[model samples]
Target: MDLHLKGKNAVILGGTRGIGRAIAETLAGEGANVAVCARNAGQVAETVEALQSRGVKSTGASVDITDADALKSWIRKAGVELGGIDILVSNAGAMAQGNTPEAWTQNFQLDVLGAVNAFNAAEPFLDKAAKSHGDAAFVIIASVSAAQADRADSYGPVKASLIHFAKGLARENAAKRLRVNVVSPGMVYFEGGIWHMIETNQPEFFKQANSRNPTGRCATPQEIANAAVFLASPASSYTTGVNLIVDGAVSNRVNF
Candidate 1:
């Protein structure tokens, strides 16, 4: 598919590795200039280089997505550097699971507020892009856990909040041609990712978890990235205020 993404500019938060890295590479492959930000400077640099190698402009910065001010600055700088921000992907999460207050704070600040801040900081550029190109997008990388919870933890609830937030943004920004959507992935596995660590440290438990999925395995980062990029592309201009689940039948809960 063409995706009509040529020359478009995108910025992704936490785009150095895993799903985020896949999204960046996929966008660049489709001829979109991409800017990425993450806390690890080395990873950010490497990702940017890889994206650029695909023949699209790419740049990155070491940034703490939890710090509102620093995140805003990097995004705006990236927006200018990339010429404009047509797509903003909030792919960062604290990934701190548990019933502790610290976990709640981490998830709330990074997962929820990270998306909020990125949208706010990039709104002007997105609006400008929409005005010129007739469409713009903000895609949030949520998780299928938002719809199911096995225990009381901050991860699922925090992810659920993102779906709510994106829906509201879609409605409010419709007139401006700024599309907002969410992609919920389940059990995505990549090297150095949460699932990979578990797979290495606890083989039996990992096998049990993977067996629960109808596919008898987990999703790859590229699989999640594909859906995310599609949502962000102008090809899906009519898609908004929707949460697309890419869980590969792993989640049995009937989406109501």
Candidate 2:
């Protein structure tokens, strides 16, 4: 399906690798001009180059999403390069699993404030895009951990807050014609991510994790990206203020 996405512009945060990278590639493949950001300049440049090779307009910047000014500056440049943003994918985040105060603070900063920064920076561009494009969208990459109580990590509360944030934005933006939605993925396997940490440091837990899921396997980044593409595209034109769970039915099962 074409998804009617050609020529649209998008800004993606934390897009150097993992699920964020997947979302960038998927949107670009659908013919959207994409701007991606990460902390590492080299990786950002490389990912931008890769996207460019696919015949999509692509740019990258190194910015800390936790800093509001830095995010605003980067968004301004990206909006200029992409000729105005039509879609904003708030994907930057980290898994802070420690139970200490410091870790809790770090998680909130990245998952909550980082998303806020992205939204604030893109608000004007998103307004412009919706006024012009008529089918503009904003997609927040949340997690199924938001709905679960068993998560031992800091990811749970952060994701839960993100869900609320998306809902609030959707409520406020519906009159403006900019659609807001959330995709909550579960147990995604990406290189050097939580899956790798589990496999290397807690093999037994990894086995149990897989067994608990009805699919008997974790989700791939591409699968999560596919859901993102739908929300970002005109395919989900009426979808707003909803959290689409892409967790292979694990979230639906009753855990005994």
Candidate 3:
């Protein structure tokens, strides 16, 4: 499928590894120039090199998303270097799972405010792209846990906030031709990802979680990335203000 992403410029937060890396690679594969940022300098460099090797203009910075000033600066610099930002993927998250105050603060700072700051910093560039190209997109990588409550966890509520914020942003930006959407992935398993840790340390729990899925497995990072990149591409021009779940039917609640 031609995503019509050639020549487009995209910025992805937390793009060094796991799901974020998958999204960055997918976008670059579709010919979008990409700028990525993460806290690990080595991983950032490696991911940037990988993207560039795919024949797309790619740049990356090592910056903590929780540092709002640094994050905004990186976004602006990326726009300048990449020429402009047509797509912004807010994929960073603290993944804080507890109900502790510290966990709540961490999730809020990284997951919620991170997206807020990135969008604010990228808005002007996105507006410009929309004006020139007739379309621009912001894709937030949320989690299916947002709509499910197996326990009291900070992560789920923080993710839910993101979905609410995305819908509101989508409506507000519609007139400007800038689309906003959320991709809520469920139990995406990768070597170094959260599910992998569960699979290793809590084998029985991981097995149960895997069995909960009718597919008898969790999603792959690339599967989630495919949905994210598609939502950010012009191919999904009419798709906005929607929470697209890529959960392999692990989630039983009807979206409606």
Off by over 4 Å in 3: none
Candidate 2 residue spans exceeding 4 A from truth: 151-153, 253-256
After TM-score superposition, the amount by which residue 183's alpha carbon in candidate 1 deviates from its true location, in angstroms, is 0.5
Ranking by lDDT: 3, 1, 2
**Candidates' TM-scores?**
0.99, 0.95, 0.99
Q: In candidate 1, list every pair of residues with a backbone clash.
A: none
- Name the lDDT value of residue 147 in candidate 1: 95
The TM-score of predicted model 3 comes to 0.99
lDDT per residue, candidate 1, 1-256, as tens digits?
7899999999999999999999999999999999999999999889988998999999999999999999999999999999999999999999998989999999999999999999999999999999999999999999998999889999999999999999999999999899999999999899999999999999999999999889999999999999999999999999999999999898887767
Better of 2 and 3 by lDDT: 3
Query: lDDT of each structure?
Result: 0.95, 0.88, 0.95
Decoy 2 TM-score against native:
0.95
Q: Write the residue-wise lDDT of candidate 3 on 142-185 in tens digits.
A: 99989999889999999999999999999999998999999999
Q: Candidate 2, which ten residues in sequence have the lowest lDDT sum?
A: 247-256
Runs off by more than 4 Å, candidate 1: none
